[model samples]
Target: MVAQEQKSSHVFDLLVVGGGVNGAGIARDASGRGASVLLVEQDDLANYTSSSSTKLIHGGLRYLEYYEFRLVREALIERDRLLAIAPHIMWPLRFVLPHSKLVRPAWMLRAGLFLYDHLAPHMKLPKSRGIDLRNHSAGKPLKSEYSKAFVYSDGWVEDSRLVVLNAMDAAARGADIRVRTRLAAAKRVDGVWEAQIEDKRSGETSTVRARAVVNAAGPWVARLLSDELAVPHSKSVRLVKGSHIVVPRVFEGPQCYIFQNPDKRIVFAIPYERKFTLIGTTDEAWGEAPGRVEISPEEVSYLCESVNRYFEKPVSPSDVVWSYAGLRPLYDDAAANASAVTRDYVLDLDTTGGAPLLSIFGGKITTYRKLAEHAIEKLIPEMPVLAGQSWTADAALPGGDLGVGGFEAALKRLRDAAPFLSLTHAWRLTRAYGSRAYDVVGAAGTLEDMGENFGADLTAREVDYLIDNEWAVTAEDVLWRRSKLGLHMTQEQRTKVERYIADRQH
Candidate 1:
């Protein structure tokens, strides 16, 4: 099971341990700056915390309550920047915060919305405004008592696709990406990082040398620093478990609802993937092992009750179509309340040891790009040859350059070229692949050319494309990470997919 080694002697300027959003983002930015980079992940890209997020590229309006104005402002700027670059996957989202006078006064809510509007004025996103809950379509699903609300602008991102597009861009820029490869250990040797990497799939291992190593392991950051690198852990990461649930689409309109709870932690009910509504997330201090973190019975009930209290249509366990849990690696601040802990990221670089191991802790998905830029800035004095000002600010992610704008037009073109594709199938492909939909459907005039049907809309050709290009190594990777087909596909279909992948290997 050894990884097909790319010549042992080929040295790298930077070695990144993790293929989550931050790691892939760092690799993309660093490699784009002309660094010889290598990014390794022990599992499929975005298969962990990155994919488990609430799936928004928001500025975190709630952070303002903790006097995190700076964090909120910076994230607001990033939200606008990401929308411009990855318009296909990232776009503007309007959040309606229905005011329940019992939870928080309307004046306090007004002040918050005022700051949210002016926080990042340089951005293209819309400003916040008061909404008459009874008149607005966004309030139709809400209970009658919630008669007033504030609507503010933020951004929504295809969380997992963001990681994939970043990794794809990094690879296209010449960075080496290794999936299912664990960073076993590392030591400074002759002023360079001599790291041992093991392939988790086949139990094969190899050693590599790099001038610098970045540990952006998210929830596993502390373990990577203390256990893998054998380095003294100076920074601590508090694992906060957040959970989300998907239910059959409940409300109409593109606007998402934000319920301000008495505990000060907000719950979001967002329009998701056309046919589903995404709601979440409960923030609780986690003392359990990181790997064992899952949505608890209490959390599920809390979320359902919170939503039911505000909405006309009550949400119960029976309405939940899917549920997911992710642990946020917050930089420990000794805050008594889990909700009060800062979500800001911190980078600790140990160049004093001759070789540098930069450990990243406590960042939100909204600010990963800026985090990557700041990270590379810290390494400039050490790796002087790594050139760059910042280029990612305006760059488009893979399949993101939808040149004109609407992906619907692109879908129309795809339909013209491949008339056999069903309307739903064409829409899915266009949204997923963007302009590259043509390459996927290339010369296939009929449904038969799509190769074997594995159930749902998944076809053999798409699976092969994921394996060859996206580093999809298993059926779960295809179903869960690469696509949400697992939600719709039956258990029998899932088994068939597993067999297809295994039989292909044989």
Candidate 2:
């Protein structure tokens, strides 16, 4: 039976299904445009593919080989735009691509770099240049055979935090964000969509009315369309599993490595969590449920072998401390190889017989903002009440208001305000929350005032903030998504956190 109290009588202009980057971004954009929006997620925000990305705001450099110039240029532009808007969570990083004669010739590498640089002329990042690995700092951990490299610029993002920030911004703009809520079914009712939503935790059902629906369900996009919405989509999504491994720091450098495999696939080795190196991801075809995806033993061995091929210190499966896998719901373009499939997104607007249903396919993290803008544009005819302009491009996500002085300035201000906080604690908070770090820290004047320490600088006060503001309900939500403190905490510490959150909920 439907819970009468949970039912929403008010009709939202748009109902965004999915709470990943794309969905959150769409809700933020649409709500900012004065459209009443309701966003529902089956799980915590960025609980899957969004958080499991390579975590780079980069143009798919390899896509240029496939002649995806438009996607590359758009991603390149978005990279800078993301950096400018969220300097605290997104910032510039230099990438070192060691030239392999066995993979590609120097001329081809140079040419690719040239195109990457010139693709977005207005980009503020430094241009790519050749470097002799023999004398460079980035070559210290590499084998002596790798004597030359090409360095270029890209941006790094706190992938999960980016999603949460967008949701927060949308909620602040009066959008209703419902997490742990599943979209059970939907049917067209007199030219409008009446969606049945279920609270996963309570087993309670409700109904919501909307003028339009956005299917940004990522891996579940195809299934949701066919099963729930009853919409026949001719276009299909190819689910490819990408896996990553986290190991002890491979090298002592700030630069990341883009290694080329003999199979023509590339793997990235990036510094992560300040103490570990992240290397991955293998592109293998997946046919299982997206949520059940996990890195296989073969994938671990492949990744270890991929890194061992270059580094002087061999990496084995034993060296891996953590590993994760996510399925990419790429648009099936009939490519012979999974890696050859286009990384660009495709939007299909269905306005045939009833209300509009926009299904998003094959989008990358680097271009989610643009994807949202385009999604809203497609719905403008259905929602003429929406503002005539796109405003998200110039707006900042929540906690990302760094002001004109940038990240360092924001960090300094946070440190000065909270003299009780240690340098490491203050820096982490500033990086994670930007100007809003003060909100989490609050009026605490001493360490004890921050409440229980669950290890690795994760205070109870921060946990409360996440629960009250960010919709974090469990220890996993706090440790993994709200922040990656799970990487730094022991099993005992994690259990304590779980117990604490459970007690609080009770």
Highest TM-score model number: 2
State candidate 1's TM-score.
0.97
**How high is the lDDT of residue 108 in model 1?**
91
Model 2: per-residue Cα lDDT over 196-302, one tens digit each:
99998888988999999999999999999999999988998999999999999989978999999999999999999999999989999887777858899999999
Q: Number of clashing pairs, model 1?
A: 0
* Best by the lDDT measure: 2
State how far residue 451 of model 2 sits from its true place (Å): 0.5
Worst 10 residues of 1 by lDDT: 1-10
Q: Write the per-residue lDDT of candidate 1 for residues 1-506, one digit (tens) a residue.
A: 54554327767999999988999999999999999999999888997889989888888888888999989999988988998888767778888888887788889989988888888778787788998988888878988988898988887887888899899999999999999999988898888898889888878778899999999888899988888888886689999989999999989989898887878779999998788999999998888666636788899999998888898998898888889998888999889988899999999988866887788998999999999998998888888856677899999898877766367677787888899999999888877777777777767778999898888888888887888888888998889878888887899999988988888777
The RMSD of every model to the true structure, in order and in angstroms, is: 1.8, 1.3
